[model samples]
Target: MSRAEPKTRPSDPRFSSGPAAKRPGWSAKSLELPSLGRSHRAPLARGRIAHAIELTRTLLEIPADYRIAIVPGSDTGAVEMAMWSLLGPRGVDVLAWEHFGGLWIKDIVDQLRLEDVRVLVGAGDIRHRLTMVDWQRDVVFTWNGTATGTCVPGADWIEYDRQGLAICDATSAIFGEPIPVSKLDVIAFSWQKCLGGEAAHGVLVLSPKAVERLLSYTPPWPMPKLFRMKDSAGLLPGLFSGNTINTVSLLCVEDAIDSMEWAISIGGLSALHQRVRDNYQVVADWVAASPWADFLEAVEPCRSRTSVCLRISDPKIAGLDVAGQHRFTSEIAQRLDNMGAAFDISGFRTAPPSLRIWCGPTVETNNLKALMPWLDWAFAEQELHLHQHS
Candidate 1:
């Protein structure tokens, strides 16, 4: 029989992986900024942008020499910008375990039309063996698989003193997860994830090696102003400063700063990580107890602490093919969303059928705790719905 309706619900029912929930006490009024209405390049606005970069450096503990910038086009733009600019000089090994990773492969193979490319694919939640990767060539991979719910265990797999650059898409990691920036050459992420800020801008971090590449080589293709990192003089130092390549949303900038300020007040990165731990534990405990569910990324260490993806483990449901299972799981997600117990908990469109919950730093642990029973209720209800429809 279907389980009785859950007694509690998440207070703020937003569990989407991207554009995650705002901090506990966030308000639109908090975004009322001195730079809001002014030009983004103006003194007040530029200062705010500069402050965001410093906060990012402090929160992420980036090395003193690493150059960081707020680039246009969110995380995708940052990744492609680096790829287009720096990839042609050497062979590249691109890893694709999930949706975003696949996009980077396309950029390298199709867009850039580079012949010397090795695509290492780890479909589903499994990991591509890093041992198989040739680190001598430039390598690009996602730090966390947002869609697959898997991540590289750590930077141990990456060669410490390799000749190639390690370009990483860290959109779903960063603030909630500890990243050894020293292990990476180029890193990209957006404020819309862990920080729960507004979007359309990305943070790009470049190591000294990355800077050397920009100074030494240039892409043969026409560099869109958004992708251009340097001009005839040298690396665009102003990009790392307050000057952006194009106009940026001041509203988003204000929101990003507001979120970072909140993070600082709550003991900074350590505090944010604690919140991630607490929230993930809430789901992990529920999954442990649930007879009907399990983590999509089967390996414990590979599971994402922020975008926690789960699959149905019930034999009857699990036996179905991908499309059929997706329909069933989508129903369960829809029911929870309709009841206002959760929102956008369904897996990504391209990924296997699953429930992907945002257990990021901004999410309150109590909310996830309240969400657990509702998930059970939704699953049971969906089971009954399938029977009745049949």
Candidate 2:
């Protein structure tokens, strides 16, 4: 038996899709000294959070009227806070393309037990035909479906004058893409993903309308202390400003600020978008040249420029039964990991058997180019193994 070849390069291009690659030269230690284990209610923690919110506004160009808050629980918490607070006042239309959107729909219809829910689901990959439903009702959607590597092209699909709220889960798309703030009422994201910070905290951005709804509407059910946005029949201004119900790590806050500053210094959102687009191009070129691979997305325009999902086209590999195809792809992914050429290139468990790659801003295009050869090598190794077995 021979030992696998050791990787000569950094394994940072692992690209598992979430908790994405951090911005270059980013370090949590760069922030002032403070133990994150301490209570986040401390003055120092509050200041750190305030700074993060300010930077988020600057980087994303959020409207001055809109308020940004560092809330608990990742993007899920932020979105749910918006949902629980605002959904009771109006009907909701949930647009689901992939798993995350599906989860949001489930929460609205099942967990929240909302009776009037309209859902629009597309076929094939999330890039399929998008049927427009009534926008007069509250609309909930993920701006980018991280799992399927698909995204709606801005808020063009939304009707701005409609008497409804637009709630967006932009965990993976925020900062990396262009989002029309005017079209969005409530937006939610986590510190992870495009921001590349720690995973425990969520950021909620509330438009004027969203705030009004929170202040006016009374949810039919009791709300948890953490989820409760309206207490004493008014929106908690402190919750939107700083000092959330629970303490958040000051270090994470500092890291998030650093990431935001980096985004601003490097031409803000435009630079961030260019970086992601460059990364996707690297993968696209690889897919075009490789005989054994192609993107899962049917059309080029609908494909995701952030999370690039690919399918192996080799007949020798695809010729296998469904189970065999899975095993073969799994073996290739494992081999790449064992060699340290990549770490988490395996397709999402819920999605079809296809390779998902992260092409976010933090990922180096050169690194992706270098990794493509390794992927080819890994697949070739798999073919050799299959030949031997046969």
Candidate 3:
């Protein structure tokens, strides 16, 4: 018996992982009044940036002493800023399970030529191995690995009285996952990820410890102007207050503010958390019943609710060589895209061939429910195409 294509379709299909879908009712008209022609250092422009920083802090429940700054080059920039300034003070532990984490490891081990660095690697979940690390050394890891849909469960395993800083790349997990601000010394996230804002700017949060490190110490290497966060006057206070080191698109700031406002209206962080869970649950339920696919993260607790990755499990699809598997999954994603049922569902090229769906707060649960049957339809179409061609 052959399965018939579902008649119903998702109302919206703009689910790329980064620059994820915007808030349900967002409009370009809402951003028309941004300080387009004025200097970013202009009073009004600076105020807008400061307002965004303040609102983000309030919504995320960051500690009062922790400072927030908007930085250049998105989350990567912010993470590197922390590394360049703080790593040499002590030995460093670099952990990885996926793409972004691996990138940071390379920067610390290869680029910076840090002699005391220790690298820890894992295939899916790296949380369990946190115990083996020496807390006396600075720790760097990703709170959520967007490439593989895995995340550190929480900060429970971290030592409370440890002498090291915890720097996290939380670009995809900030809004959806609850972060223990007290346990983290530095956190970096981009507006483009879970917040559904425009790209190229990052939000960097620093604990008092991180700030102290910056003020008291500096990397031996000459830092780029874009990465400089401190000077003779001490830490650049204005950066935290929205006087950016470089110009930013006022339009993007306006859009970020709009998204943050929408998040607040919908009940802040708790609501955002529930939104992602509900969206993930929709796909989770489908995957539970669908024999053709399964989540890449075998450990349920470690699976990411935002970037949900699904691997083809059926032997017919899974038996193919890596190149063939990529082609098959590409075909499925392409078929779905052509049908307007989904967009950008292909897994990261660096990752194994699979499908990754964005289940962040901006993605509607109803739309995800509407999408599953279409996924089934697409899979069937791909199977039939491969059978005929072979």
Candidate 4:
């Protein structure tokens, strides 16, 4: 028998991993006070920028010595800037377990064409490979595998006295995971991620060591004006404050401030982390109960609490070949979408067939519980549809 559709729907269904679900009650009216038309150099506009950085530091409990700047582009821009400026000083090690990680490796090898670079990969057991790497080489990696839903268990894997810099692309892990700032040299994330702020700009947090490296070493390659962080005098200190290298949408800035304010009100990072923990627990409980569903990342410690990807192992879906599996997975996601039970829960375009649900802080645990029944209904309906059509 086909299962009946779920009667209760999630109150808010904006669950795309990037530009994720907005804070509860977020609306366009939140931008009313922004310095929209004013010059960013003006005191009012600059103060807004400074406030955003400061609140983010407070919420994230960032160390005082670290510099946080609003940079051009999103997380990609911040990561690339760090790579372009700090990589050539020594040999670099790039690590990958998913799509974003692969892109950084390509940048180091294909784009920069760096001779002394090593790429380590595996969706599971990457920590073992990381243990074997020469820490003397500058290392680049993502804090979370957004596509694969795996993350480094913790910063304990890092060598405390390593000579080279650790540049991490922490776009998805920033608010959702605990990152040891003392161990990371350079970390970058966008406001549009777990915070659920608007996109088109990013925040780059640089440790004092990273700043020192930027000031002392200049890359041999041509640095575009957008990527350059230094001048003849050395690292541009102004950028670390409120001065931006390029124009940003003040509307987005206001939205970021609004989100940061919301974060602080909810007891800051601890509250946010608890919210995500609760959200993930709801799905984890469901997955434990459902014989047909399993996590894409089997390693519990490495699983991402933010982008939760799952594979269907039920005989109905698992027996299908790769192409058939893809179709079946898409059908399930589409059915859920058409029913207004979920949105953007499809796995990444490049990843294997699965469902990638956003379990970030912005999402309420109750909503996830509500959505789970819809997921079960969708899968059943999809199987029935396949049977009738075929």
Candidate 5:
């Protein structure tokens, strides 16, 4: 039997994980461009960058003692900077739950070749291994797995008075979820993720401990100019004060500021969290009734609200081999994209076959509610086609 076209389509179809949907009512005209052509070092441009940093601090509720800097590379660059600058000082415990976390592990073992490293790995749910990690060693993990949509419930598992650092890659979780800033030593995220701003830039937040590590220890490997955060005279004075290590896009700065301002106007962090919660609930409810799909993260607490990844549950699709599953899911995603009901909702290239939806604050709950039916429609359509051909 053929499933009918969805009676309603999502008002806006963008659902990409990164470079995700823009904030509601967002437009290019909404961005302030006075600093567009100006040099990054210019007063106007520098001021905008500084404002963006401050806005990030305010919205995310980062502690005053923590320093925030706008770095050259997006979240990837920021995480690399942290690992390069601090990991040599002590043994580290790294988690390899998803794409980015796995990469961090590779960097720690293969690239850095760190001798004393403990890698704790898991698939959809990694909570059990949390108890296995020794807090005495520096810990590297993603607060939320962007690819798998699994997240640690909270920071309570972290040792408050541990001897080592807690470095986190929180690109997709920053504004979209609540983060405990005090427990983290090095936190990295990109403007393009939760803020729905443009790419090519990352925000690095450092606890006082992270700064002390930077000032005290230097990695044995060469540090690139882009990753260098300090100099001979203590830390770089201007680096955190909007004096970026390299040239930055002034236009992107304005866009980040615009997003932050929008976030602030809409009741700040709590409001953003509420928006994410509501949006996730809409998808969760749909999945609860979905005969063919369910979230990859089975544990409710561990499931990420921002990146909601769903796996196919239908017998025909689930029984397929890895490559077959990939091809099937990719085809469905392409069909949805072509139908103009959704776009970029496919699973991460490195992840298992699944549908990853962005339920960040920028994405509207109404749109997600509308999108649920379309998802069912697409899945059923694919099933019908399979039945006829096979």
Candidate 6:
């Protein structure tokens, strides 16, 4: 089958990196509001936003004093907003293991043009090295690198007593993992990932310290109207509670709310964590059985439970060098997609060539099971084709 062919329906295993699988029984009709077509300033939109915030707070067990906001531009908006607002006041340290964390390091060191910035990057499979850095500086990192399938185990690596604030981009890891609330000062996520809601909106959670940073310190650069979090300070009582800047899809908001409720009813964070862990095991078992498959993450403990990345390890493929291996892997991914076995399993462009599978809460383990045979079939087909061509 060609890429043009509708290979799989929505009911088929959806393994797309973002806009992941939605929770079972989640429906847009449940969130339908008469004011969906009305201005965002309308009361109905505010009510939906309020309900979403409340549900998120309950599902994640956010602190009573913290504030949550639905912002523009998804996870990127949330992270950039936090960096623009919070990093200039203190020395900043960025911990990078993969693409998302790399973006943060670039923003701090290059985009923001901050003079006092340090970036700690780990090579192949190693999570960011946080040792030897002064805790007095601001810290920014992604809790999970969706591309590399690696993650920081928890906030325990952060210096809880330090004067610095810890900002986390938990877009893919938020609901799937356990993040200790007190350790994080600014937490940002998008609706698309684990929550499996629509794109275009982000959820920003601000600890008291993060709020203080925004209120007290202003970055040297002028902040855009959309990035401005302070104007809503007084209005924030309503902003955090009900008022949202732009109109959100009442349907998407309802879907997110339903997803959160589902998370809670099924056992909250613990259950979600277990689901991700279980999904990882499915991939792990596949890796262990196949000599051509091994986790990209160097350390087992630091490997991500949500995004599970694997490398092909056939001796012939390895003998061909990195470029040949990449070509071989790309061919395999294409074959898998054409056969309706997998979609979007190709490793990210910036990452080393490998297969990256998402093992989030909504992804069924049975789908992963189904995928293994397809992977084996595709690889074998590729090998046969290579032999014929040679």
Query: Which candidate leads the pack in lDDT?
Result: 5
lDDT of 1 by residue, 176-202 (tens): 888888989999999999999888999
150-261 per-residue lDDT for model 3 (tens digits): 8887778877787999898999999988888788899999999888999999889999988888888878988989889988999776878898989898888999999999
lDDT for model 2: 0.81
Q: Number of clashing residue pairs in every model?
A: 0, 0, 0, 0, 0, 0
- Native-structure RMSD, model 1: 1.3
Cα-based lDDT for every prediction:
0.89, 0.81, 0.89, 0.88, 0.90, 0.81
In candidate 2, position 226 carries an lDDT of 84
- Residue pairs clashing, model 4: none
TM-score of each candidate? 0.97, 0.93, 0.98, 0.97, 0.98, 0.93
Backbone clash tally (model 6): 0
Task: Please give the lDDT score at residue 218 for candidate 6.
Answer: 69
The reply for model 6, stretches above 4 Å from the true place, is 1-11, 27-35, 124-128, 232-237
In model 1, the Cα lDDT at residue 196 comes to 96
lDDT of 3: 0.89
Q: Estimate candidate 2's RMSD in Å.
A: 2.4
Alpha-carbon RMSD to native, per candidate: 1.3, 2.4, 1.2, 1.2, 1.1, 3.4
In the range 1-390, model 4's lDDT, one tens digit per residue, is 789777899887767898899998888886657588999888989988888889888988999999999999899999998898888878988888899999999899998999999888864666787786678999999999889898888888898898999999999989888888889999999988899988889899999989888888878899989897778887676888788899877888889989889988988898888988999999999999987889998889888999999999898789889888888888888888888888988889888889999999998788898999988998888888888988
Error of 2 at 53 (Å): 0.3
What is the lDDT, from 0 to 100, of the residue 174 in candidate 1?
Answer: 90
How far off is residue 5 in model 2, in Å? Answer: 7.9
Deviation of model 2 at 384, angstroms: 1.9
Residue-level lDDT tens digits of model 6 in 90-179:
788888888888888888887889998887885754433766456899888889898888888666667879799989999999998888
